[model samples]
Target: MIFTRKRQPLNKLTIAHAAYTLQKEVKWLGITLNPTLSPNLHLRMVKTKTNNTIKQLTQIIQPTFGLCQREARILIVGVMMTKILHGSIIWYTNKNRNTVRKKLTGRLFQAVQLSTGMMKQPPLPCLELYGGIRDITKQNIRLAHNYLHTKLAALIDDGHRTLIWKDLTVPQPIHPSPLNNLIEKNTLLQQHFTRTETLSPFPVPPWCHRGSWKENKSGLALRNLELTWRAPKG
Candidate 1:
């Protein structure tokens, strides 16, 4: 696909003695790339897939049948959400595009409603609140922020980091990338380094022993003490 905002004629080209034509859109690495680089097509495809999945899930999930509320919530989070937000880091932005956001959220809210066994009359905020789901826009921003942080952490050279930082944080009057929008929305991201750094090292250590700790008195006592210390205080 030829990515550009200007009007241009599609010209055929020959590669390795084979003639090729320009495509209106091309799917690469699961993301749809169009001539204008707009995410509308990709979002539409995702919406269709999500709707189909929801339809199939409705068969097994009911008000009081196949799946309980807790199981429904798990499925929504683990399956539906993962599918909906699949390449969101590349396409999502919390800008002034309410039309796109509304369409996406409306479809997503259906899954939440199904999980919660509620009708469609509830507002988005109410649906998200009772459904125990995060807003799509917020989640996209979070994923972008995490992506940025991870990228920054991986860069060892200060010069490379500075270049990347300036490129992403620099103000663009005309058009801004998703990362730029994220930085604009959260001023804290403008900092050279994130205040809250998260690390996911290789072979993550287990939080506790493998076996049943309740069998050992000392382990049980330690667990209770830890739980008490971590518990919310009144």
Candidate 2:
């Protein structure tokens, strides 16, 4: 409750900034946001026999644009990387936050050629990870950002290349013009599909949604108030 309320405003602004950054970086890339959400689903299963938690999810095999199913696996990783990068960069710099506010309010919302949608199902993998969000509107931005930053960073790094929108909506790119390439060379861009633990400094500019972790819980639940007395031994 406390964290959500405190983060409400920041989250919105952060998304706004990211939208702007994406525009500047991807303007010539010819990727359109899917307005109709194909809706990705992620499920978590606990193996009773093994007494271990296993995560089950679909691949984020989005090809430039289109629709696909995927797991919420990327969210935790992006947030983790963001939490670390935001702290180091934002704090280290002595700049104004006014730009970040401007980008979120002005650019992200103001855009063209985008396909957008949210998950139709509930009890999502993210619910357990996020302690359960009530609606997609509140959390989808972060989810998408996590997906884009970690997953789509390739598009940003590849620079001046045209990618086939192999996903769903548009065939071939709307813009074949060369892109300026907003990123520097890094190994993660090559390995996003295979490696999971790869980390990099988030590329959000001076003004963007950047935050520190209030708390990041590592293990699963501890006490079950009602079942405290009869709980199985660890």
Candidate 3:
């Protein structure tokens, strides 16, 4: 069975004298996978789920029984945001995000405004800054970073070392590519391996530095270290 964007008829698969046809999309473990492996359907599902949660939160937070702004902020951070972003990093892609970015951002803006007790939705940036909430893009990146960090840590662990090495192995080039050879010939690629830049002897001090008796006790003070010019003896 085959799935395609075109309307062409597809051949049927027969098993035990029974015929089965291809599907345009398949749902597995709550994620929709299409033939192209495109994330459009996944993004749509995420948007739908997020919008539903936002709607529910809005209804539950009516003035009469609504939480105060502070409590609402906590709820937004702890619950609503979590629900909206669940499994986001796994299927997130720039193309899918570009397709639904505005709608998703608008929904997020509305959710934040409602939760924070704002009279009206502010500009997205203002909502992010003044409302003390990260924009959707940053939040998505953060989730991806944290998830990758944890997965990498596990992969590098002794029990999974082999798995890590296996996964990290690069696939062999099936067919030689003229473009790849051309790219490898570039001077920049050679320069990358030849560049030699030694680390500076004295870099910027740590954020909190314990000082000597002559220096300030508070670690907040920036250390003033200087090197005087000297001429070599002839």
> Residue 54 in candidate 1 has what lDDT?
53
Worst 10 residues of 3 by lDDT: 159-168
Least accurate stretch of 10 residues (summed lDDT) in model 1? 220-229
TM-score of each: 0.24, 0.17, 0.25
Where does model 1 exceed 4 Å of error?
Answer: 1-51, 54-67, 78-97, 120-234
Clashing pairs in 1: none
Positional deviation of residue 229's Cα in model 1 after best superposition, in angstroms: 24
TM-score of candidate 2 versus the correct structure, residues matched by position: 0.17
Alpha-carbon local distance difference test for all models = 0.34, 0.23, 0.34
Cα RMSD to native, each candidate? 21.1, 23.8, 24.4
Candidates arranged by TM-score, highest first: 3, 1, 2
Of the candidates shown, which would achieve the greatest TM-score relative to the real structure?
Answer: 3
Q: Cα deviation of 109 in candidate 1 (Å)?
A: 3.2
Residues 39-128 of candidate 2 have per-residue lDDT tens digits of 121001101211111111112222222222121113222222222222222233435445423322221111100111222222145446
